[model samples]
Target: MKKIEVFVEKANDGTYWGSTQNLPGGVSSYGNSFDELKQNLKAAFKDYLEVGRKLNENWVQEIEQLTEFEYQLDIASFFKLLPIKISAIAEKTGINPSLMRQYASGKANVSEKRAREIEKAIHELGEDLLSVSF
Candidate 1:
């Protein structure tokens, strides 16, 4: 079964948003809470996959097994889901370890620009991994 990576993020308005990087453009979902976001993302993903399958005959087999597709949280969401040390993420994103720790522990508020920087790093890493053929 193939895995679909979903990047979940907290929006500026305090809402949650989720989207798959592997899917075509415009496939996204939003919610007021993480639970709502999860449900919305699942439904939105299924709908998006259906539309994709309709446009591509070769996707029929995959579409038929859509239930088998695994959904995973990426980067920030992963960190939020588990108890990961901020130092590790800081090393990966090239941010100051102390500041990262503060952010992770809710001791320091991250500005939008800094948040974008962290996100950009994650996306860049994802792109690099995607370029590798297994």
Candidate 2:
């Protein structure tokens, strides 16, 4: 068995969403509460594992490798903290505020570029705060 870390976040619309950091399409259900979201994610992971097992191909190993990647990054806590506001993130990343809000609220799909921008912004913020504290 492989271990994968799941991160959950509460969207602005009062729903919860979660994903595994290393799995490209490993995102799970969006629900009105954390427990509901977790339950849905459990079901999703079970189905994913079962499908991989049924396929009887190298896909199961691939998924295990992906989970390993996630473990290396220690991204399980990525969604645990909401450090930056959508407006601030938009201002920093030059992304539209509405789009940022939509992405943060889980109302819209995050484009690759947008996701990169968000990641960059978060990284910069983390570095800055660390520098200030140190």
Best lDDT among the predictions, by candidate number: 1
On residues 57-111, what C-alpha lDDT tens digit does candidate 1 reach at each position?
A: 5755654464533345434455565565667568888899988877765567778
- For model 2 the local lDDT of residue 13 reads 71
lDDT of 2 at 78: 37
The weakest ten consecutive residues by lDDT in model 2 span: 68-77
Model 1 spans with C-alpha error above 4 angstroms? 24-26, 63-100, 103-134
lDDT of 1: 0.68
Flag regions of model 2 displaced more than 4 Å.
1-83
lDDT of each structure? Answer: 0.68, 0.64
The TM-score values for the models, in the order shown, are 0.49, 0.45
lDDT tens digits by residue: candidate 2, 20-97: 765545756666766677677767876887777797756676674543312221122234334457677789899898
CA lDDT for candidate 2:
0.64
